[model samples]
Target: MSRILVVEDNIGIRNVLEKTLKMKGYDVFSVGTGENAVRLFTSDIFDLVITDLRLPKMDGLEVLKKVKKISSTTIVIIMTAYGTIENAIEAMKSGAYDYILKPFSLEEIEIKVEKALSQQRISNENIILKEEIKSRFGWITGKSQKAQKVYKFIKKVSDRPTPVLILGESGTGKELVAREIHENSSRRNFPFVAVNCAALAEGVLESELFGHERGAFTGAHAQKKGRFEIADKGTLFLDEIGDLPLNTQVKLLRFLQEKSFERVGGTNTLKVDARIIAATNKDLKEAIKNKSFREDLFYRLNVITMTLPPLRERREDIPELIDHFWSRYTKELHKDMAITPEVKDILYSYDWPGNIRELENAIERIIVLSEDKVVSIDDLPMELREGISDIIPKALPDNIGFTERVEYFERDIIKQALEKCSYNQIKTSERLKLNRGTLQYKMKKYNLYCKKISTKS
Candidate 1:
C-alpha cells in the first residue's frame, strides 16, 4: 500500500481528506502543520504529501522544499483556494506534483492522489531496474592481476565526477565496465545514455551529442535531446570515442571545460551536469598523432584511463565466465543445459579474439540449439572447435556392461570436479550442475572421497 500524508490546517478538511483517502486504500497520516509533516517524514517515509498552501507556521511551499530535500523522488501535492492559485503554480515550480483547489470533491481528492501515487510507483520501479542493472553487468570477476586493478579503480572513482576514458580492443567489455561504474555511482538512479561516436556522420554525431532543434537540419522534424541533456545528473558514455570527427571533438572539449552547450540551431547557452565516460577500440594516442583525434579533448577525457585486458590475457577466468553465461542462458531459455568436459576443454583452449562478448554469444548459441541437456564437443560451433585438432578419447578399462560404463564416466567427471573445487562438495555440485544430495549419493556409491584435498577457495 502507498503511504500518504495529509497536511491541512482546517481540522474538518483534514479529517474528510484523511477518511476519503483511507477509503481509497492508502496509508493516510494526517498533520495540521507542515512542521509536523516534516517531523513525521524524518522518522518515516511517505509516498506522497498533500498540504494546503496557507498554514499557521510553515507554508505548503516550504514543506514541499523540505520534503524534496529529505527525498528527491517523493511526490508533493499542494492544496490551495482560487485566491492562492498563483501560489499553487509557484508550488508546482518548487516541485509539487499537482495542486487541488479548496471546496474540492472527494472524487477530486481520489483522482489526484491516485495519479500522484501512480507516478511514484513508476519512479520506484526505475530505481529497482537500476539496481538489477548494477548486479547484472556490474560484476567483473577474474583472478588475473589486471582484472583486480580494474576493480580497484572502479571503487576509487565511482563517486567522483571525473572524466573516464576506457581503452580496450573490441568485445573487451569496455561498455560493461562503464555501466558498472555508473550503476555503482551516485547517479545510479539516473540515466546512463550511450552513443557510438563512430556510427554517425560528423554533423549527425554533433546533433546526437548536443541535441538539435526542430528545423535545425534536413530531417530534424522535431526537437530532440541529445545524449548529454538526456544524461544530465547521470552519465553519458561515448562509445568508440576515437572515431569522433575533429569538429565534434572540439565541442566535447568545450563541454568538458565549461559544462555548457547549445542546441544545433538555438543561441541560448544550456548547461547540464552529466559525467562523460568514453570507450574506444582504436588507439586514441595514435589517432592523435595521425591528426584524426584532438590532443586537447584526449587530455580532458583521459583524466582516469582504464584499459581492459583481452580475454586471452585472463585465460584462468574462461571456465568461470563460461559457467556464468551457461547458467544465464539456460535459465533464460528454459533449458537444462550442461557441457561435457571435452567441450569445456575446447572452449578454454581457444583464444577468444572477440573477448567476453564472443564467449558469451558462443555459450548462448550452444544452449539454444543443443538437442540434448548435455553439450558435447560435437555440439560446439564449428569455428570454435576448428582450432582443437581432436579431443582424444579418454582410455578406460573394458566395460562389462552399459551400466558399468555409465558409472565409470560419471565417477571420472565427478572426480575432476572435486579436484577443481578443492573437494568442496557444494562448489563441486554447483560447477557440475548437480544438486548437493545427488552428488553426495554418487560420491558414496563410487567411494570417491578425498581426505587429502583442502576445501578452500
Candidate 2:
C-alpha cells in the first residue's frame, strides 16, 4: 500500500485530508506543523507528502527541500490558497510533483495522488528493466575479486557524463561493458550507435563518424547523418579506437571537446548532445609514444578508464561462464544436453585466448554438432581433448564407482577412435572392427555422435 503524509496547520483541513486519504485505502499520517512533518519523514519512508504552503514552525518549501535531500525519489505535493499561488509555483520549480489549490474537492485530491503514484510506478519499472538488461548483457557475472571490482567501478561511473575508454584485449567484452553503462544511465532510452574504426578506410570512417552529403564521395547518393547525430542524447561507441587515423582522431577530439560537428562536404555546423565511449585492444600509451595516437585526444577520451582482465587471469570464472553459455545455447538450439565431468575438467583447465567469445563459440559448436542429449569428451574439439589428456592423470581413483569407470572407459575409447578416423562414423566403425549396427548401438548407448562443426571463418 502507498503511504502518504499530510501536513497542514489547520486542524479541520488536516482531519479532512486524513479521512479522505484513509477512505481511498491509503495509510495516511497527519501532522499540524512542518517541523513534525520533517521529524516523521526523517524517521520513516513516505511515498508522497502533501503539505500546506504556510506553516508555523517551518514552511512547505523548506520541507520539500529537506525531504528531497533525504531522498530525491520521494514525491512532494504543495497545497496553497488563492493568494499564495505564486508560492505553489515556486514549490513546483523546487521539485514539487503537483500543486492543489485551497477548496479542492476530494475527487481532485484523489486524481492528483493517483497521477503522481502512477508516474512513480513507471519510473520504478524502468529501473528494474535496466537492471535486467545489464544482467543479460554479461555485466553481472561471477564473484571473483576482479569481476567485483569491475562491477563496482561500472556502478560508480555509469551515471556520470564523462567519456570512458575501455582498454582490454579483443573479445574481453569491452563493448558489453560500454553497453551496460549506457543502459544504466539516464540516456538509455535513446539510440546506442557503434562504429568499427578499424574496419573502414580513413575517408569512409570519417564520413561514417560525421556523416556525408550527396556527391561527397564516389558512392555518395544522398545526404546522411553520422553516428554522432544518430546517437544524440544517447551513446556513441567507437570500437578499435586505436586504429583511427590521425586526421580522424583530430575530428573526434574536436567533437568531444565541443559537442558540435559538420557533415562531410557540408558547410553547416550541427550540434549533438551525445556521450562518447571508445574501446581498443592496442597499447594506446605505446601508440602515443610512437606518435601514431594523439596525446591530447587520449587525455580527452581517457577521462574514465576500465581495463578488463583476460580469461586466463580469471580462470575461476570460466566454469560459471560455461554454465551461463550452456543454458543460453541449450535453449536456443532446442536441445536438452548434459556435459560430463571430464568435459568440465577440460573446459575449466584450458587457457581461453579468445576469452568469453571463444568459450561461447565452443559451447555453441557442441550444441550444433552433438546429436545426443548428453555431451561427452568426444563432443569436444580435438585441441581441448588433447590439452585435457596431457594435463589430467589417467589412473582411475578408488573414489570412482564401477558403473562410472565403465562409462569413462567406453567414452574414452569412442573419443580416441573418432579422433583417429577424423570424426567419420563409418570409418571409425571399420577401424574399430565392429559391425555398423553395433557401432550405432554403442554410440547411442554412450550418447556420442560424429557431427561436424560449421561456422564462418
Candidate 3:
C-alpha cells in the first residue's frame, strides 16, 4: 500500500485530508506541525509527503528539505495559498514534487498524490534497471592472466574520458569490455549509446552520427538528434568501426579532432562531449594500408587500445565460461539440466573460432532442447562432437558402480586440466576453479601422478 504523510497546522483541514486519503485506500498519517511530520518521517518511511506552506516552529519548505536530505527519492508535495505561491515554487526547486493550493478540491489533491506516486514508481523502477545493468555487464569474469590484465586496464581507464579502441576477433566480447568500462566509469549514470558503423548505408551513416536537419533529404522531414548528441556527457560505442566508408571516415576524423560536427546539409556546427569507444573485428591497419580506413582516425582512436584474446587462446578459462553460460541459460530456460563430464571434455577441447559468443550460444541451445537432467554428447552440436568422439577412452571398468564411476570420471577431468596447464598445480587448480590444497588432495587420492599422462595435447 502507498503511504502518505499529511502536515497541516489546521486541525480541521488535517482531519479532512486524513479521512479523504484513507477513504481513497492510502495509509495516511496526519500531523499538526512540520516538526511532528519530520519527526515521524525520520522514524518511518512514507511514499508521499503533503505539507502546508505555513507551519509553526518549522515551515513546510523546511520539512521538505529535511525529508529530502534523509531520502532524496521521497516525494514531497507543497500546499500553499496564492499569496505564498512563490514559496511553493522555491520548494519545488528544492525537490518538491508538486504544489496544491489552499483552496484546492479533494479531487485536485488526490490527483496530485496519484501523480507523485506514479512518478516515484517510475523512479524506483529505473533504480532497479540501473542496478540490473551494473550486475549483468559491470564485471568481466575470468581468472586467466590475459583476463586479469583486461580487468586492470578497465579499472585504470574508467575514470578518464579518452577514446578507447577495442580490437578483437568477432564474438570476443569487445562491446562487453566497453560496457564494463562505461559501467565502472564516473559517467556510469549517463547514457551508453552504441551504433553499428557497418550496418547502415553510407548515406544513412552520416545522418546517424551527426543527425539531419529538417528537409535535409526526401525522407528527413524532421530534425533528428544523432548518437553523438544523444550520448552527450556519456559514452558512445561505435561497433564494427573498421567497415566505415571513406566519406564517413573523414567526417568521423573531423569529429575526433574538433569534438564538433555539422548536420548533413546544415551549416551550423554542433559540439558534443561524448566519450568515444570503438570496436572492430577487421584488421584496421590493413584496411588503412588498402586506403579503406583513415590512418589519422586510426591514431586518434588508438589512444587507449584494449585487445581481447580469443577463446582458443584463453583455453584455461573455457570450463568456467561454460559454467557461466550454463548457469545463466538453465535459469532462463527453466531447465534442470546437468552437463556430463564427457560433454565438458568435448567442449573444452573444441577450438571456438567464433570465440565466447559461439560457446555461449551452444550452451543456451543445449539447455533449450534438453529434456533430461543429464546433458550427454548427443545433446551437443554435431560439429562440436566430431573429430573428438574418441576424446576420453572407454576404459571405465564394467564392474564399477555409479559411485566408483563418478570417482573415475572426476579423476580424468582433473588429469586433463593438469595436462592442459603443463602439470602446473597452481594453474591447474585455477583452471579447474579449485584451491591448490584441494586439488593436491584430490590428485593424491586419485593417484594422478602414479601413471604417466597419455599422449594427448
Candidate 4:
C-alpha cells in the first residue's frame, strides 16, 4: 500500500487527515510537528507527505525542503488556511506537490492525494523502464578485466571535451558505452541526443543535423533547431557514423572544428557546445581506404576510441549476462523460472554467431513460451540445441592426456557459460555449481575478461 505521512501542529487536523487517508486504504503516519514529520520520513519509506504550512517551531516549506533532500522522489503536499495563499504558492515553489486549504472536504483531499500518488507511480515506472532499456545492452553487465578496462577508459575520457568514437559490432552495446560516457561526464546534466546516420538518407540526415530555416526545403515550413542545437551543452551521439555521406561529413567536420554552424538556407551562424560521440559497426580504416569516409573526420572522432569485443571472444561472460536478463525478464514477464543445468550446458556448448543480443532474445523466448517454470533443453529453439551437438565432438581419443583434455574442456565450457550469462558472476557460479570466489579465480586463471565476449567493431 502507498504510505502517506500527515504533519500538522493541530491534533484535530492531524487526526482527521490520518483517519481520512486510512479510510482510503492508504498506510498513514501522523505527526504533530515538522520535526517529528522529518523523523518519520527518515525512518520510513513514505510515498507522500501532507504538511501544514503554519507549524510550531518548523514550517511546511522547511519540511518539504528536508523531505526532498532525503528522497527527491517523495511527493509533498502543503496544507494552508484560506488567507495563506501566498504561503501555499511559496510551498509549491519549494517543491510541494499540491496545497490543501483549511476547512477542505475529506473527499477533496482524497482526490488530490490519489492524483498525487498516481503521478508518483507513473514517475517511478518511467525510471524502471529507463533502467530496463539501459540494461538491454551488453556493456552494462560485467566487471571482468576487459569490462573494467573499458569502464576506466570511459571514465577517463568522459570528462574530456574531445569527441569519442565507439567501435563495436551489431548488438555489442555501442550506444550503452555512449550513454555511460555521457552519464559520467560533465555534460550528464544536459540532454544526450542520439542519431543514426545509416538510418537516414543524405538529404534528411543533413537537415536533421543542421536543421533548416523556414522555407529552406519543400517541407521546411518553419524554423527548426538541429540535433546539435537541441543538445547544446550536452552530448550528441551519432550511431553508424561510418555510413555518413561525404557531404554531411564535411559539414560535421566543420562543426567539430569551429563548434558553430549555419542552418540550411540561413545566414545566421549558431554555436553549440555539444560533446560529440560517434559509433560504427564498420571499420573506419576500411571505410577510409574505400574513400567512403574522410580521414580527417575519422581522426577527429577517434580522439578517444573504445572497441567492444565480440561474444565469441568473451564467451566467459555469457552466463552472467543470461542471469541478469533472466532476473529482469522474470519480474517483467511475471514468471519465477529457473534455468536448468542441462539447458546451461546446451547454451555453453553452442556457438553464438549472433552474440549477446541474440542470447537475450533466445532467453526471453524461452521465458515466454516455456510451459514450466524450469527452462529445460526442450524450451530452447531447435537450431540452438542442434548446433550444440554439432559443436561438441562425439568421440575422444584414448591416447589423449586425460587431465589436459579435461582442463581444456572445462575452460571452454566455463567460457561459454560466462558469455551466455553476460559475465555476471553470480549467475555463472550458479550455472557451474561453483561459488563466486571460485568462478572469479577460474576466470582470472583462464585470462578471460568479460569484454572478450561481445565484439566491438
Candidate 5:
C-alpha cells in the first residue's frame, strides 16, 4: 500500500482528510505541525506528503524543502486558503506536486491525491522497465562484489553530461557497458548511435562521423548527417576509439570541447548536444605513449572510465549466463532442449578466451543443431571437446584407489552439472542418469546442498 503523510494545523480538517484517505485503503499518517511532519518523515518512508501552506512553526514551503532533501522521490502537495494563491505558487516553485485550496470538497482532495499517486507509480514503473532492459541486453551480468562495484560506478557517471571511456579486452563487452550507461541516463529516450573506428579507413571514418555535403567527394552524391548529428540530444558510442586516426581525433576533440562541428566541404558549423561514450579494446595509455593517439583528445574522452572483467575471471557467472541464453534462444529457435551434465562439465573446465560473445554463439549453435530434447557432449563443437581433453592429465597417482578416484570425478561432474543447471534437481538428475532421490543423496553426501540454490523454477 502507498503511504501518505497529512500535515494540517486544523484538527477538524486533519481528521476528515485522514479518515477519508484511510477509508480509501491508503496507509495514512496525520500530524498537526510542520515540525512533526518533518520528524515523521525522517523516521519512516512516506510515498506522498500533503501539507498546509500556513503552519505554526515551519511553513509548508519549508517542510517541502526539508522532505525533498530527505528523499527527492517523495511526492509533496501543498494546501492553502483562498487568499494565499501567491504562497501556493511559491510552494510549487519549491517543488510541490500540486496545491489544494481551502473549503475544497473531500472528493476534490481525494481526486488530487489519486492523481499524484498515479503519477508517482508511473514514474517508478518507468524506472524499473529501464533497469530491466539494461540488464537484459547490456551484457554485463553478475551480482558479485566486483560486478556490483562496477554497476555502482556506472550509475554514478551515467547522469553526468560528459564523455565516458570504457577499457577492456576485445570480447569483454565494453560496448554493452556503454549501452547500459546510456540506457540508464537522461539520454535514454534519444538515439544511442555507435560507430566502429577500427573498421573504417581515415577518410571513410571522417566522412562517417562528420557527414559530407552533396558533391563534396567522389561518392558524396547526396548530403548526409554524421553520426554525431544523428545522435544530437542523445548519446554517440564510438567503438574502438583507440584506432581513430590522428587527424580525426583532433576533430573529435574539438567537438567534445565545444559541441560543434563542420561536415566535409561545408564551412558552416553544426552544433550538437550529444553525450560521447567511447570504448576501446586496445591499451590507450600505451597508444598515447607511442604517439599513435592524441593525448588531448584522450583526456577529454576519459572523463569517466569503466573496465569490464573478462569471462575467464568471472567463471562463476557462466552458469547463470547459460541459463539466461537458454531462456532467450529456446524461444527464438522453438526448442525445448537443455544442456546435459557432460556438456556443462566441459564448458566450466574450459577457459573462455572469447568471453561472453563466444559463449552466446556456442549456445545458439547448440540450440540450432541439437536434435534431441537435451544437449550432450556430442552437440558441442569439436574444438571445445578437444580443449577439455587437452587440459586433463591422463595418469593418476598409483597410491590412489581406482574407486576413490572415480568417486572424485563423479563429484566434480555432478557439481559442474548442478551449477550449469542452476541447481534444478530434476534436470540435474536427468542429465546424470540418477533418480531425483539418488541425486539428492549424493548432493548431501558431497555437501553441495549447503550452497544456496535459486528457486526460480
Candidate 6:
C-alpha cells in the first residue's frame, strides 16, 4: 500500500484530504505545518507528499527541497490557490511531482495521485532492472579493486561529451567498457556504432567513416552514409585506433573539430553530432615516435583516457570468475556440471594470457566434454595439464594396478581428441580412425561423453 503525507495549514482541508486519501486505500497522514510534515517524514517513510504552496512556518518549496534531500524518489504534489499558482510552479521546478489547484475536486486529486504513483512504480522498476544488469556484468567481469576503480571512472565520465580513449589488450573488454559508458550517458536512446579500425584498409576505412557518394569509387553504385552519419546524436566506437592510417587520422581530426565532413567525391560538407570513443591495444605514444600514428590526432582523442588491467593482475578474482563461467556454460549447454578442486587449483595457478575470453572458452570446453557431473583435472587442456604436472607427482607408483593406468591413458586421449575436434565425436572418431560406437563406448567408460553438440550455433 502507498503512504501519503498531506500538508495543509487549514485544519479542515487537511482533515478532508486525509479522510479522502484514506478512503482511496492510501495510508494518509495530515499535518497543518511543513515543520510537522518534515517531522512525520523523519519518523515514517512516505511514497507521496501533498503540501500547500503557502504555509505558516516553512513554505512548500522549502518543504519540497527538504523532502527531496531526505528521499529524492518520493513523489511530491504542490497544492496552491489562485494567487499562489506561481509559487506552485516554483515548487514544481524544485522537484514537485505535480501541482493541483486548491479548489480541485476529489476526482482530480484521485487522478493526479494515481498517475504520480504509476510513474513512481515505473521508475522503481527501471532502477531494479539496471541494478540486475550491473550485478550480472559485475559477476562476469570479476569485481576486483582494479575493476571497481574502472567502473567508478566510467560512471564519473559517462555523461561528459568529451572523447574517451580506452587502452587495453585484446579480449580485455574494451568495447564492453565503451558500450557501458554509452548506455549510461544522456544519448543512450541513439544508435551505437562500432568499427574495427585494424580490420579495414585505408580507403575502405575512410569510406566507412565519412561515407561516399554515388560513383565515388570503382564499385560505388549508390550513395552511402558512413559511421559518423549513421551514429549522429549517438556514440561511435573506433576499436584499435592505433592502427588507423595517417590520412584517415587527419580526416578524423578534422571531423572531431568541426563536427562536419565531406563524403568521398562529394562537394557538400555534411555536419553531424557524434561522440567518438577510441580503443587501442598498441602504445599510441610509441606509434607517434615511429611516425605511424599522428601526434595531433592522438592528443585530440586522448582528452579522457581509461585503461583496463589484464586478468593476470586481478588473480584474486579467479575463483569467482571460474564459478561464474562454469554456471553460465552449464546453463547454456543444459548440463549439470561441476568442477573439481584439483581442476580449480590448476586454473588458478595458470596465467590466463587470453584473459576473460580465454577463460570462458576453457569453461565451455570443459562443459562440452565432461560427461559425468564433475570436471576433473584430466579434462583440462595440455598447457594446464603440463602446468599441473609440474606441481604434483609425475610418476605413477608401482602399487597402482594396470587397469587404473589404462583408465588414466584413455581419459587423457579422449580429452586430447575432444580438445582437437572441439568435442565433436564424429570428427574425433574420424581422426582417431575408430568406429563412432566404439569411441562412444570408450568415452562412456572414462566418463567423457558429454551431451551431444547442438546443431544450432
Model 1 agreement with the true structure over 1-457: per-residue lDDT tens digits: 8999999999999999899889888899999998999999999999889999999889999999999999998899999999999999999998999998888898988998888888878887887666445434324657667778888888888999999999988888788789988977999889999998878998888998899999998999999988899999999999999888888888899999999999998788999999999999989889989999999898899889988889888777888788877877887798987788788878886788888888888888899888997898778898986765533336667746888777777887788778767899998997678999999999999998987667888
lDDT for each candidate structure:
0.86, 0.88, 0.87, 0.87, 0.86, 0.86
Candidate number that wins on TM-score, 2 or 3:
3
Best candidate, TM-score = 4
RMSD in angstroms, all models? 12.6, 15.0, 8.3, 9.6, 14.3, 15.2
Better of 1 and 3 by lDDT: 3
RMSD of 5: 14.3
- The estimated TM-scores of all candidates read 0.59, 0.59, 0.64, 0.68, 0.59, 0.57
Candidate 1 yields a Cα-based lDDT of 0.86
Tens digit of lDDT per residue, candidate 2, span 234-314?
999999999999999988999988888899999999999999999999999999999999999999999899999988777
Residue range 1-457, candidate 4, lDDT tens digits:
9999999888987898899899889999998988998888888899999989999888888999999999998999998999998999988998898998888998899999999999999998989967865687767787667777777888899999999989878887788888988989988889999999999989999899999999998989999989999999999999999999999999999999999999988999899999999999998999999999999999888888889877776666777888888898888899999998678767766667777788888888899999897887778998887775533535567788988788777777788778767888898898678988988898898887866455766
Best-performing candidate as measured by lDDT: 2
Inter-residue clash pairs, candidate 5: none
After superposing candidate 3 on the true structure, give the runs of residues whose Cα lies further than 4 Å from its correct spot.
Answer: 1-139, 395-457
Give the per-residue lDDT of model 5 (tens digit) for 143-229. Answer: 555577778988899999978988877777777788888878988889989999999999989999999899899989999999999
Candidate 1 accuracy as TM-score: 0.59
Residue pairs whose backbone atoms clash in candidate 3? none
Query: Among all windows of ten consecutive residues in candidate 3, which has the lowest summed lDDT?
Result: 131-140
Give the alpha carbon lDDT tens digit for every residue of 1-457 in model 6.
Answer: 9999999998888888899999999999888898998998988899999999899879888899999999999999999999888788788788998999869898899999999999999998898666444533333366688888888988999999999999988767788788888888998999889999999989999999999999999999999999999999999999999999998888899988988899998999999999999999999999999999999999999999998888788777888888877876787689997788778867876778987678778888888988888888878888778777543435678898998887776677676667657889998997567899998898887778556769997
**For residues 61-117, could you state the per-residue lDDT of candidate 3 as single tens digits?**
999999999988889999999999999999989999889888989999988898889
Give me the overall lDDT of model 6: 0.86
